[model samples]
Target: MIPLRQLPRLLRIAGVLARHRVDELLPASRRPRSLAWLRALMPAPGADLLVLPRGERLALALTALGPIFVKFGQILSTRRDLLPADVADALTQLQDRVAPFPAAQARAAIERAFGATIEARYASFDDAPLASASIAQVHAATLADGREVVVKVLRPDIHARIDADVALLRALAGVVERTHPSADKIRPQAIVDEIETTLVNELDLQREGANASLLRRNFAGSDDLYVPEVVWSHTSAGVLTLERVRGIPVDDLAALDAAGIDRVALAEKGVRLFYTQVFRDNFFHADAHAGNIWVDATRPADPRFIALDFGIMGSLPERDQYWLAENFLALFNQDYARIAELHVRAGWMPADARLDELEAAVRTVCEPYFTRPLSEISLAEVVVKLFEVARRHDLTLQPQLILLQKTLLNIEGVGRLLHPRIDIWATAKPVLERIWRRRSGPRAVLRTLRRRVPEWLAAAPDMPQLVHGWLSRANAGEMELRVASDDLKEIERRLRHGQRVAIWLSAGVSLAVATACVALLAPAGAPPGARWVAWLLGAAAVGAFALAARRS
Candidate 1:
């Protein structure tokens, strides 16, 4: 049942739709008079024409609603294949714009969450937020020892609002599943589940703090990526304190140009950083939108990427990481057959399916881009085509792999935006090949064996006993292997019954055959009827044995 107070909000949402000429997107059964009444309350002259495009309007609407919608738009923006080009293009502009909460509120939240006063903990506290998004805002401050830091505070009562939206989405997803067959293909429920998990993780600033720490550790001693230090002493579930960062936004081409940064080199560096994260580290920043990325332009010749928003990071399973590395290398080398084989080996397709057919499909999707210059090829299109082929082959990707795919596409997009003629393969291929060789070559085998030597030594004492037990089992006719499961109970029962039938038939056939042989040898009581009976029994016994074998 719908809550009474929620009706007003729902009606207001309806009214906004009618006012903005987006009523068509809503269900048709809603009351037109109520919609008209809500539209009447809309301010005059409507929104600016520049913002009316579906994508831009979506961004504006999400921002107006708050963080939940903004986050949704961010995820949606990654799904270029599932969305219209215009809508997807516009959603790229959605930033986490939010009004910072007053300092008093920030203090109150910190106090409530940590049971301490701001002044007692820090040298000075600022009311002004360093950054604000839909769910949380960050404020700059100083520790008593004089270290600079930033505090992240969750938006007041944001969870209640987020929960409501998630519940609504869950309910709507059910309806879509029941009514639209396409919903099953797209897996709306799974998508919602991913969104829910990511949002929940982001809500806990402590998790974000830990994520930042892991990333910081991963990039330690590296010059390509910078992850800020988290102040563990002050971090909490709803609040986080970390080292403050200052850099030029990568998208600010004007600022980059003024700094005399080489746009081409910077773009290549971005691609390299991405490959390093995904292949070498297996951990990557999932959210690399322009706003979350910055260039440390202090050294124009050696520009480094400054990543923020660690709340939504990604990682792949070891198997997926290996497969992806292999896939990238295979595609770069134009090994279409290897790509097809990897898909099948990864259980992305049925074993009985025609490999030639899949190879043909891959060639069809990838052939057009072969040997083309970087400016002429669309990596994003290639990814979409791969996804389409996967769907046709009934390939269900691991969730982590999906994130990796999206992150790769996002990195490519950002790279191309910086330099239109950037060759992604040129920048990433060498890194992938090196990693692949290290992980798959003879050296890797030696390393793996070296790591396992201790365990092997520990097991050496048991080898003699293990071999003896194996030989003992081979000598004993009583030796048997059995597995138990409830699902096979009926089959087991049928097999037992069939075993008895086979035994009785075999005995009867043996008696008849012996009698026939004796009669034929003695020729004293031999008869045509007896011979016929013997032959019939022998045929019946053979048939029973065959049936029993099949049943077993």
Candidate 2:
């Protein structure tokens, strides 16, 4: 049930829908009073009822709503093939800039979160925001040592607002699942779950700080990429302080051109960085849009990427990682059958799926791209189509991998914008090959043995004692045997219960028979004829129990 206090918000949402002439967006056929009543208050003018492209209108409305909605739009934009072309294009323009908060409020919130004055921690602090995003805004500041840094502050009342929105989204998802036929395909609840995970992660600035620190460690001593340094002393869940980065924004092509930077090399490095993160380190930044990327034009010929946001990231399970590496290598080698086999082996498709059929499905999606020039190839489009085909072939792709695929598409987008002719496959293939060779070759086996030899040596002293203990247990008659069965588990339970009852009843019958036999053979003994009869009766009872035992 919607809370009483939250009904007003629900009414407001309905009002927004009514004003936008989108009452059909809400399923009011079921709840006329709650949903339709609001729509009835102010009917959409006839002029407003005209149909535009569903995707574009949807994207525009989401972006206009605010930061949270804009972020949602950006996420949906990555799923181009799932959406109509016009809507995806509109959502692609949903950048992360928003109006900044006042300096007083920002400083006060930071002081309250830290329980101290900002002056004590910083030599100088600016109230003006250096940049404002949907979730948080960053302000320029200086530490006590006169080192420049940026302070990221979460928007006030964001948690409460998000909590309310999530509640509504969950309720809406439940409603859609019940009413809509395509709910199972779209997985509305799962999308909301992903959003909840990503948004909650964004709320914790300290976690983002740690992510930055790890990425910095991964790329240490490298020239292709750089991550800002997190100032541990000043970072918190609500606020983060990082070494301020000075670079031309990756999206600012004109500025980079002015700096004499090689856009082609910059684009190639982006692909290389992505592969290194995925295949080499098995860690990657999931959110890498133009706004989150910057170019260090300090060295024009050797430009390095500066990654900002780290809240949303992705990594694969080890098995998936292996299959993905093999898949990429196979694609590079034009081995579609190998790709099909990997998908089946990885349980990405049904176990009974025919290899040839799957190979054909893959070829149908990939063949068009193969004939295209590198400059004309949209890697994102290829991935989206692959997903479409995979769904048809019964592939329930992992959610984590979906995020990675979207991130890769974003990186590819940035790359294509920088240099249209860069061969992403060429850059990525060598990295995957090196990783596969290191993991699956004879040298890897030798390395593994070398690492394990010390453990083997350590166990040598205890080997004889362990053998002796096993022998001693065997001789003492204290051994236990266990049998495992999966096929007859139910039958086994029933059989064991039956045996317990049969054993008790048999013992009772045997005792009675023995007593009768003793009485018959007493001093007041039975005559010869009767004694034979008693023996016969006793034997019959014993034989009956033996039959029961055999059946059991």
**TM-score for each model:** 0.78, 0.78
Best by lDDT: 2
lDDT of 2 by residue, 1-552 (tens): 566777776766666655554444334554335445665677554554346554555655565566787887777665543555566667777778889988888898889888999987788998879989888899999998889999999998889878878888778778778777777887788878877887898899999999999999999989999999999999999999999989998989999999999999899899889888988888999888898899998999888999988887778998999888888788788788998899899998899998998889989989989898766767667767777777788887877777777788789989988987778877777777887787779887756655664464466456446645754664564553334776577677676678758866875675565454446323354465644544554555566555445444
RMSD of each: 15.7, 17.2
Q: List the residue pairs that clash in candidate 1.
A: none
- Top-TM-score candidate index: 1
lDDT of each: 0.75, 0.77
Q: Pairing residues by index, what is the TM-score of model 2?
A: 0.78
Any idea what lDDT model 2 has?
0.77
Cα deviation at 472, candidate 2, in Å, is: 10
Off by over 4 Å in 1: 1-6, 14-53, 79-86, 458-552
Candidate 1, residue 46: how far the Cα is off, in Å = 5.9
Candidate 2 runs further than 4 Å off: 17-52, 76-89, 442-552
